[model samples]
Target: MSIIIRKSLLELIFSGAFMKRWNDKLRPMELVEVDKQAHKMIVAWLLFLLNSRDLDVVRKRALGESLIEGGLFDYLYRLVITDIKPPVFYKIKENPDDYSTLTNWVIKQLRPRIMPLGDDFMNRMTAYLMQPEDKGLARRILHAAHLYASYSEFKLLKSINRMDHELIEIEESFIERLNSMRDLVGVSELLDEDSNVLGGFARMCGRLRFQKRWSQTPRVPETSVLGHMFIVATYSWFFSMEVGACRARCQNNFFSGLFHDLPELLTRDIISPVKGSSQEIGELIHEYEIRELNRVVLAPLKEGGYEDIAKRLEYLLGLEVGSEFKASVNMDGTIVEATEEQMAGEYNIDTIDPKDGPLLKVSDSLAAYIEAHTALKNGISSGQLHHALYRISNRYNETPVIAGVQVSALLADFD
Candidate 1:
């Protein structure tokens, strides 16, 4: 159902006490014109808040002080001075003091929610926003981030559809930048300590094909995050394309790969055998994962009144609880019965041809090679790798596979 949020209603929504008192109240069918504009502006503001590195609300709250000198005035001035048109400037100017008051009030209210984020991270995010040319693009990216945080994958489809081409492109570019962040040493390090953890986790998820090897390593290995993500993104894209899925679906598949490993950040990459011993053990481990993650990764954000990062991850992965995680069972001395799905939904691209199923098959093959390569790098035997390769070639012989030949060619890389 559609909710028509207006100014008066928004004031209530923004009011912490008021919102709590009428938690069940919903918006009506109609909105005043001013209210509609208000809605758009608020949406835009939220979009800006989420996507931009500048507004580190969580970090600011966590630090227990305003990092920016002018408080909300500093924020509004930054907004207006950076790419805001003359009319928007005039609107701000007409009631400058009132706007300042409203903005400060909003920030004060939000500060409680964002304080857990810490000051250091908040400063960096604000600095990113201070860059002039990035303003419009930043807003779009922030909007996508916010929508993703609030809704489901399907909701992302709707959100993107509702955006104008310019905004969509802006958001896409932003996402691309985020995808590429792991390639840089500074960015990867910064993300580990701050808000870009989402991006860092995405890169890890995309790299899941390298799991056993990655787990065995002392750490992620400085540039391994980039290397793994490239592999997953490439495989996901190739697989979806061969299947004839639409570009959008293919993109989502790539994103799915990117997000697959996020929970590992919180849970510390539990190996499959351990997780599969029993349901109770698994649940206990799951709870520990959430607790540790909140303490290490999300507790900082809690100071700012933000929701649980693990809970946000549950929404992203589309699971009600962590019980749905994949398990790998050792069937015999060199055989493993492994089943895995990173997200709740089926891994199918509607626009792609059914024949493209081979792409998924290829992704699996490439992942195996990455594991083998990593294992070999660490001086492990290639026996398991060879066994997996044998399984795939054997499957192809039994059925005609799309891009079967191309995939076979790529398998040579594993060897």
Candidate 2:
């Protein structure tokens, strides 16, 4: 069965941008749901790496997929049920019947977007949320990631919170949550928050919140690299499913979109124009990013006994293929570009570790187009943004349906 690319689904994911976090208290910087989800996933990945080194590769990938799906389930649920406070939501959750009714409504709204992934995925989302209990490693990792992300927000608002009467109770709740997750692997160090190893990873990702996209241009609800990454990752998963990508390919595509711009964290978000000014400059920038990624991020993790995570990162970033936009498969110890037929055929299996790079690239471009389209629609006009929207729209118009996504139609919705 083929999946249709629906504007509603894409819009639903982008809706996160408008969702303000900690709305009750003032914050130094804008806190948005999309960026928080991205930060949480990053922390979750680090925790996954630390805890799963001894696990088999199959289980490791399954765990990763579980976290991604489960995290999205929670995110989508929160998106619609936005008005309720956390305490109130938990109270409702305690009543299984109430939780089920509300969660079922959420599932119903999301079904058109999610059922394409298959019945199993739908079942998992319902079960994960409905259980409302510790569901083992994947759930623990999700909870810890959620807590760490919230705590990061808390730290930022600490000074502001100091003046608020409810700050103490909120702070104590965070402390209690952290204490509860101390038993989680690699989470104990996060308790220190300032000097610990896991905290360092979280901080680096958190800093991305400060690095807003299109800095030269203004937009309502300015998005961060972290938020943009989350949108792309979400889009990639949706696109991957539409293309009937295998489980490995789908997960690979999603994570690749998530981390594709991670090197930008090291080099800053160098605009495409500047990067493409000259072949020499583009290659030079690429070489620099690769060097820095290995030196600062990867080597340290590998040395710290996280070689598997480092290796996977290298693969996802297309260090071997020279670009993450190229479809690829690991074949006989070498990463090789694979054709559509090959991907749909023998390479679909998880053992080969296929990645739908081309699909990810489409998702990446869609995210960018939405960003520009969103700004323009919000009345923040600029030559650069218009040019971006025009370029992307025309590109898809020229060759619509990239990797099974109906690109032209999706763009039409913005018109």
Candidate 3:
């Protein structure tokens, strides 16, 4: 059954961009929920990589799906209850009966926007929210990633928060919770200031918040590459579900969307125009990205006994089939391109380890369209931004229905 990718849901997810973090505290930069959610998922990826090293493919896929689902659940719930402070929210969460009531209310409020995702998502969301604390690996990873991402922001505000009496308890609580997770594979490195591989990787992901999207253009909320990746990731998951993608395939799409722009971290955010200026220039940039990615990202990871992570990253980055935007799947150990029909039919099974690259492309372009549309709506018009909106709109106008999604209609809804 092809599901409707509703306009309200897209706006609801993108709405996180406007939701502020550490709102009451003095901050150097505008810390938004979207970017923090992105960072948390990135941290969760490393944790997933570390902990799944010994698990089978089935177990690995289950854990990956749980992490993605849990993150989305938490994000959606927070979107509805925007005014509650972190301390107050946590206190409420501590009381199971009270939190259960609050969760039910949040579900009621969000159902209208999220109903397009269908019943499975709704049921899963409720179960995850109501699940006992620390009952699963996904929950533990969630706890660690939240603290790591929050602490990254808190460190920046330390100059202002140090003397604030209210934050003293919060500071100690963060450390103590993190201390309990030291046994988790990447948790120690995450907490360590000087640890090499994992520490460097986490820092690089966090630094993406400083790398603004559409750098040449002025916008209401200048989004970061990290935040944009999350948007695409979220869209891919929704599209995947709509297309009835199998468990592994859906998870693959989500993570592929999440890390799609990682090469940008090493090469910086090279705008699409610069890359497409000429065939030679595009090829040269691609060549450089591959060389640098191997050296700076993959090589170090493999050397640190993370060959599996490196290999999967290579696949998700589309190193084998040319571009991550192209649909492909792993058959046994070989990577092969698959058609949209095959993705919907034969290749849909989890054993194929399919990644719906075409679905991801739609998600990627839709995200770009929304970003452009949102900026223009906010009265931050520019020739470049307008061209972006036009190009993306026209690009999908011809065949709006891609990978079972009404792409053209969804784009039109933005207007």
Candidate 4:
């Protein structure tokens, strides 16, 4: 909870892990060309948005019949699909029985992870998607966008050696289909002229695939900034659940974790050691990141009438908190009410409160530890990674709890 620990958590989140997808093995791509964890998170977020749309219609139609809700189906679907070994996926694609087996395998793997809801939701999802009916306008549109994003990522990786023309055509076709369905889905009513915002955001998220992590480490798989964001977000979500976070707090933490490093998209991944070299240097870097973020990211969104979204991002990224370092969200997702003296004296000192920033910091460290452990497991050797693992482990060893969650137990799961 000290400033040093807080800064270290931020550093680790920005530090990329080398994660290799099965597909990368077939191509000339490096062993770790993609951030597997991050990609899954992005897919999850997309699905969350899709499922979040049209709650009113879904509630009315429920009419007492139970229906799966809250984007869980979409999230689970992407999580399983992304983790599928490439060769297995290819085999499934080639045979009907294999695909069926794959689906069952996915259900089995996910069943234990998702408790309480159990197989009922998973079974419903399998049955629903197998032969989906017209669920609603929003559901359909979001579903198309999810498919488009997933396919786009898969096709691009698959066609690394192929000509761009085919890829371009495929993308164009997908976009055309999405645009055609826009009016039918009443997107204008939902978002007005800002209907294109989601698409634009998707494109930006895609850029993370190109921004490689750990530029200095050789012979290791590279993680993208975007992917790191996803991992942090996912970790934060699960950690929030462990702490019994309210719905609004969980959502805020997830999103905050998702965009924690959005500034890196503009400034690139500045390693933590460099930022921590000196207090003055770190302050200067922070200043520059905020300026560029406002000019390049937030200002434009505001100009485009996405003020609400821009404000949310600002809060998530701690832009609004400034130097006070207070909690970002309350139990209801509203900004935590704290005077400057109260924030500095109590909140800053007791950094383990069940607020957004501290919880996110803990999740960030957990993610960093996982990334380092994963890379080490994959036979990559780096002193920096080893040091990171040691440092994180040692730091958390003395601290066993955060916001009522057993932090040590959560980290132990990685071991």
Candidate 5:
């Protein structure tokens, strides 16, 4: 993709949405006060990590049967009751047997623009929702995510005014749960090494809530950097599915979208316009970002035997890796296979036939368009946003297809 496209993508991710939550009037909650997309993304990432555990094959097989029988959908049904008095909350509470209905409702709310995996996702979600034994890792992780979301929401509330007693109580309760369950998910190991790693990471991510987008424009609710990453990752996951991305490719695109701007955690969100001021300046910023990432993030992970995670982050952020290639193991499991020159030229990436790189680019553009459209609908006036909507519309119109997916038709849904 060209530099201009890249810049526009970043700008869109940074733009915030202006919708209100159903339960905003009930309490001093930050759900509708902060970036909704970012919170959803955080929840999704937590879900991803929870699902990636390497369970023993024998145990997994044994638990798999039990999971299917034990109402896995019911577990997910309860996890989404973040509000205490919402009608949905009472509806589920009143009718305990509405698991399938509630599960489908949640899925509809959470479903992306395009579901590449389709119905298979519910089965996969069943596996992720399984809790084999007492210290069920999946259940614990969901609880942890719930607590973290509450903690982060309360923190956002603190920024606008004095923290409410109810919010403080909620935050403290989450902390207590986190403290109790820290040992369940290898957070204990991280805590022993760096006593505050978990909390620090959560706090850092929450800081993105305050980092507003379109600083010069009038936005009803500004999008944060963290929220933008979540939206991009969500979009990428759907797009990846639409293009028939392999398992590995789907995971990569989802995670890459999740942490694409992680360097911003340390460097702050360097706006796209500044980054694209000139090629030389952009290169300089990239160098500085890498240097700081190594010093602040990667170096510690390496010292703590988290090299695998560090490398994954590097690949996702395109730190040391170039964007023009994708590599995968062949079915034979010995030699690697790569797309030839003509295929690579046609698809924009040399390694993966599905071309996740360009696929993510399209998702990024779509996310930007959504951000602009949402803001405009909410009465945020900005010449830049208007121009962006027009530019992206024209750009995607001229380029109708990407990685075997009909880009124009996919985007037409937004109209």
Candidate 6:
């Protein structure tokens, strides 16, 4: 396929000097197309031409042919017109085996007339945009890009400002939504666990504290599925680290914490009232949860050869009651995997680091308590904070776990 752009616009796009000099002299010229494919590719090419001055001519030509050959002109056109630039070069270069000479040739030929934004920048943009459309970040980026691409720089700047304002608003909303979920998920022992997909779990948990609810559920807190996973994972890391567990164990704890409630995503956080109706009914629900978990999170990951991740989580969770994991497990560890009643059973398992569960639980409780206390400071004062703390303290017989650790008493250091 062949398409042509006026040499002047090509220079305008490629040579900033020419663009500046001929800014007034230049007039729009129709792009000549040799075929339907050529026409589509030219639209794609011109869209990019608007931003690229450093792309070599050879590369531009190659890009044109590649766009045509790969049936990517439409995608590229949408991207370019929307202020999103596709990675026409790097995606091809990164895996030459997938995109060999023909692809490379097209990219090289079309290179000169386009912008030379680095591949990393393009890839990050792609990743950001390609996320699920419902993602707040993606929506913000799309809105910003739409305004920027269609308007002059002056308008674009304002559009950017508005977009930022919207983002801040959304962030606040997200936080309000995630607060309850954050508490429920309860960042436990594995926040810093090491799994390829779960490595950022801690940050994710922290961010959940800020998620906003989109739905109205009086009993259920407004939180995102991702937010819950993040907090639980973080708690897992804290637990493991405080317990002085091995590095591998620490990572496993993190992964386990992240996925412990994954079944909830599939099962929809069944309330205890319904779940505890009868032994058979409860068992049936549990069975369904396990099956759905295996079918969704576990199966997909294993099919993708990510069973290692699942195993890591399960190991950290100590889901499989074995001789070895018993001594090392904490109260939260058992609670995550056990039936509510089973959790209350007189199971005497000595804590490993002695300070592990106490530190983690205190940290978790204190975080929520502080948040509630802050609300009191904001003129929403109720006896709720004090009463809640009293009830919680009374549960442990008022003998808190951090009694002996001076460092642990300094909860002010936590952010």
Local distance difference test, each candidate: 0.37, 0.83, 0.88, 0.55, 0.53, 0.35
Worst 10 residues of 1 by lDDT: 16-25
Q: All predictions: root-mean-square deviation over Cα?
A: 22.5, 2.2, 1.7, 7.9, 7.5, 23.0
Cα lDDT, model 2, residue 176: 92
Candidate 1 has a TM-score of 0.35
Q: Which parts of model 3 have CA positions greater than 4 angstroms off?
A: 132-134
Determine the backbone clash count of candidate 4: 1
Q: Report how far residue 124 has shifted in candidate 1, in Å.
A: 33
Which tens-of-lDDT digit does each residue in 20-112 have in candidate 6? 111111213111111112222222222233222356655543332332223222223232233212235335445646445533443444344
Top TM-score model? 3
lDDT of 2 by residue, 1-415 (tens): 5566677788789889989998888889889999999988888877887788789988988888888888888898888887687878889888879988988887788888766567776787877777777668988898989988988888899986677988888889988988888887788776665665456656777888888888898987688999999999999987877777777888888888888899888988888889989999999999999999989888876776667778988999998989888878888899998876677677888888998877787888888888888888889879999999888899899998776678888889888
TM-score of each: 0.35, 0.93, 0.95, 0.69, 0.70, 0.34
Cα lDDT, model 2, residue 279: 100
Task: Choose the strongest candidate by lDDT.
Answer: 3
Candidate 1 Cα misplacement greater than 4 A, ranges: 1-49, 52-230, 273-287, 290-312, 321-365, 373-415
Q: Can you write out model 3's per-residue Cα lDDT over 1-23, one digit (the tens) per residue?
A: 33778889998999998899888
Instruction: For candidate 1, write residues 151-224 as lDDT tens digits.
Output: 22222234434544444554564456545533322233323423555444333332332233344434212123
Question: lDDT tens string, model 4, 132-228?
Answer: 3445533554455444555545555555645544556556655666566554433332223235654455556666666766667632345667666
Better of 1 and 6 by TM-score: 1
**Which of the two, 1 or 4, has more lDDT?**
4
Clashes of each: 29, 0, 0, 1, 2, 53
For candidate 5, the 10 contiguous residues with the lowest summed lDDT are 1-10
